[model samples]
Target chain A: MTKRITKEFADLQTEPPEDMKVDLITENDLFKWVVTINGPKDTPYAGGLFLVHVILPNEYPFKPPVINWKTKIYHPNVTNDGKGTMCLGFLRDGEWKPSSRMAAALEYVRQLMIEPVPDDAVDPAIAEEYKNNRKQFFKTAKQWTTTYAKP
Target chain B: MAYTEEELAQYERLSNDYVPDAEGPLVSPRQSSQRITSEYAQADPVYVHKTTTLPQQFSQYRTVKGDGNCGWRALAFGYFEALLQTADPSRVLGEVARLTSLNNVLDSVGYPRDIYEDFTDETLQLLKSTAATLPVHDDGAALLASFNDSGICNAIIMHFRLVTSAWMKTHADSYVHYTENQSIQDYCSTHIEPHAVEIDNLGLQACIDAIIKPAGIAVQVLYLDRSPGEEVNQLNWPAGPSTLNAPYNGLSTIRLLYRPGHYDILYKHEDIDILPAAAVTNPQINLMSGPVYLSSSNVCYSQQGLDIDNFYIPGLMSAGVSLAYSTDAYISNAIYAPSALPITSAATDPYSVPYSEPPKAIVESPTLEGPWNTDRFRPSQYQVEVKFRQVMPVRPEPCQTEAMKQAGESKAHFRNEDFQPQIWEPGAEYNVGRNSEPNRRRSS
Candidate 1:
């Protein structure tokens, strides 16, 4: 397992995704990863940095990693509570295949920032507001990004 | 009732997060397929009609859990089983060599060598190790043990998932039509690669093509649905044997009992010799689990349940029940006859209401087989626990054991062995001394 994990870690460090920087949370443990994803351009939260916690279960690769947004965001797919839990459709337990790549999962998270999946959202009310009232939703999202996600 | 926004989001989260709590072994011990017959006896008439005819063609089955990965697990277990059955180490070497060559496919299919090394290495190790233990005639026990261990089993199955994925990607033309609207690559990702998604027909076909066919193993899926039929619908890939030469001792085929959403391995008596260690410790598959093993035991534990269950043996009507008893295999299979009786005379309506008239089939005369020309159905003292009064036709009690003793005690020499004879031999020699006969032990 460490072989697979450290190999994945080495690959992530050497050639990280264009929008994301991934590193082990500490030098000692490989299970916890600290990730920083740049909000996509043209989106309301553009230029804002997002810190996400990626915790790989002991059954890594077999079981999926758990992700929580340490940096709050006003996206319908991400919960607005302090926990900020995010469940991308593919990352859900049933949908996560052992062959599913972490890089590809993060890409899905990145894509969600550009186009929130209002239909499959974690915060239904926020999703409703985003779908029915886009301009007002963008104003609050940008303000939240400025208040909470700015570096 | 409409849910509030908070409730709605919770519902969405719960649904997405829901993973079933899968029970039973990853791959279970092989069992009498008749357990399946008895399991469906009480269901609608169509199912009763189909499952009753199942064991006539397929005698045994090993259940793979209904867990999401059962399809992949079943195929993987079946492949290893076929290898072990080959009893030829070179088959393992050939598979290892073939799989190593498939590395070219895995790499070209866009999987990095590094990411897949763990799965590939694990798969190769098991194949090599299991074949090494062949001389012991472990009867696939070593293979079954490795499969039961989640760490080993999951890695091997993951290797299978990858091979299936890579196979589909490289050979897109044959599979392109089956992928529906999705590309072969995407279809493989969601269907073949996932640890949790059950295999659909295409995935079963691809895995069989990539791994099984090359090893010369046939795969048949018996669909046990309510489709109009006396038997389950069989789907065998490489319908006739493929170009790959059939191994001398290699499997005839790996049978899967596909009950719509799930897949379990089925074994014909012939398929089982190549599959599992004959019968292991689980005595539960006998009387406790279901009526499948109602094959033996005239000692009825439940006189009441006997009458009800006996009504459902559709196979009894196939050939005359008396005619069925003539076949030794059918006697043990009495096909779900827990409270089963051997009618001295064939009753026109054996399906008469349960517990009525003590169910006329129990032949009360000194011999149940007296009426039939075949002595195959003779009830002995061994089958005579008084608990079976209803099944034995209220025989005169004392004379029963005296006659049964000659039949039972003649061979009942091993005092310390199990109380019940492993396999009863009726009218075996009471004493075969040097003067009487020569010793002929069945030495393995």
Candidate 2:
């Protein structure tokens, strides 16, 4: 329900996660959220600012929110298309629980940037490149981050 | 490489319309038997076998709405139903106190007190009012009405879910092993705490341990899955010790019907005398006998606990099958005709095995006046009187030795001493460890 979402939004606002900022794009709609995550150091995305668009369903917590990468990134788990979709196992329809909050989802995305799971990757080509050619994978990822995800 | 459009469509249809047959009442009137053959007429061999055998063990069941919250709703309904059977205001008050105290567990588990307090308060208020009104109006109808109210019911059930989740979180070390290596917090957040999340075995166990066991109520979960068995597997949530080794003679127990993903309530015909008001008002027409069909659903108002004498013979005779009566001693006995019939009577098939001793005498005041008389129906040839035993409230003294007593005393002491709050220490090392775990896949 929106009540739980409002509580979660308030909780996140009071004590936002480290290096992450959350904002409502419109004053009327609490369902749509704009989240900004600071890429963890030591990853190819280090120093990059990735923006994520989160759209909560009417059945908010029961169904998982729809999340898309607004910023372009070259990651094994994230698609490099216009949608820039991220494949989070927990965010999948059957796997999502009402108790899982937007904060946890965002944190999971940050973790994915740090260590991409090549095994269950959305982008098959990127996954293959990451698994077989680590150097080239890191170079392209860093280049994409520098070009598209610059703060 | 991926699922075809047809496959995706099929999956969507299955997900959306899976429980079409689950549109019954939250708790339906008891049926004569489980209606096994009719219910599972379309089911496969495994379900059919289990369903057929279930009625042999359990006489009646109440269907619950197969909404996502069926598991919790079923358990809550069972808890209240069992509580009403006790008819003791003190027991209801005890539940209030027990539920109130669980807030401490929630507090320790880092659940914001303000967030969960209202839910708990709602539950406590409902219990208090129910207990307060017991002297004037104490019946299953009141309990059912309370449960049917979505606002009250949802609040109480949610409180229970939180309590179970908090209990699991508090006792994470014990439950973590059962989660296939998922951390306690993660496990609770995803499975136990969520609203509308169907309870798995571990979650069910946690609830039994936290709520039902402590409240001194036992529950038997009849598993009617596609398991190969003539008899359904029953898991008892024992009232004492909460261990497999403990003896299981609990004061009260309610039966739960468990299909693959849903749970509904089951009632023993002999245990509770008063049936739901709806069933009592509109008795289903029994085709075999003009007398009220003694199917599990027929609410016979008898104070003397289900009088086997009053059990209708024509119905059983018409079924033309010897029903297995699973008593404590004569579990192997293939048949038991509740009515007194000649050994050679059509009701008593050749396979009807007589018990060495009569069934245990159930102590209840014989109040209901019925049309059938034991004197008129008594067959001179065979007189094997079977009495269904009611679970006595007395605790077993033999099991409580000095060591066990000391252990029980120290358990309370250890609870305070060993209780550790699960606090996530936000430190650099913790972050590093989390980021570096390549092989550690998060459980979805």
i-RMS, each model, one decimal: 1.2, 5.6
Best prediction by TM-score: 1
Evaluated on chain A only, model 2 obtains a TM-score of 0.95
Q: Per-candidate RMSD vs. true structure?
A: 18.9, 25.4
Kindly report the docking quality category of candidate 2.
Answer: incorrect
Best by DockQ: 1
DockQ of 1: 0.55
lDDT of 2 by residue, A1-151 (tens): 5566788888889988777898987977899988998888998989999898888877666567888899998986666668877645777655665445677887787788878888766666778899999999999989988999899
User: What value does the lDDT take at residue B321 in candidate 1?
Assistant: 28
User: TM-score, chain A, per candidate?
Assistant: 0.95, 0.95
Residue-level lDDT of model 2, residues B111-191, one tens digit each, is 777567656766777665554432122346666777777656666677888888889888877688899778887887777
Q: Per-prediction TM-score, please?
A: 0.68, 0.58
The CA lDDT of each predicted structure is: 0.66, 0.60
Task: Please report the candidate that would top lDDT against the real structure.
Answer: 1
Runs in model 1 lying further than 4 Å from the true structure: B238-251, B274-444
What's the distance in Å from true for residue B270, model 1?
Answer: 2.4
**TM of chain B, each:** 0.60, 0.56
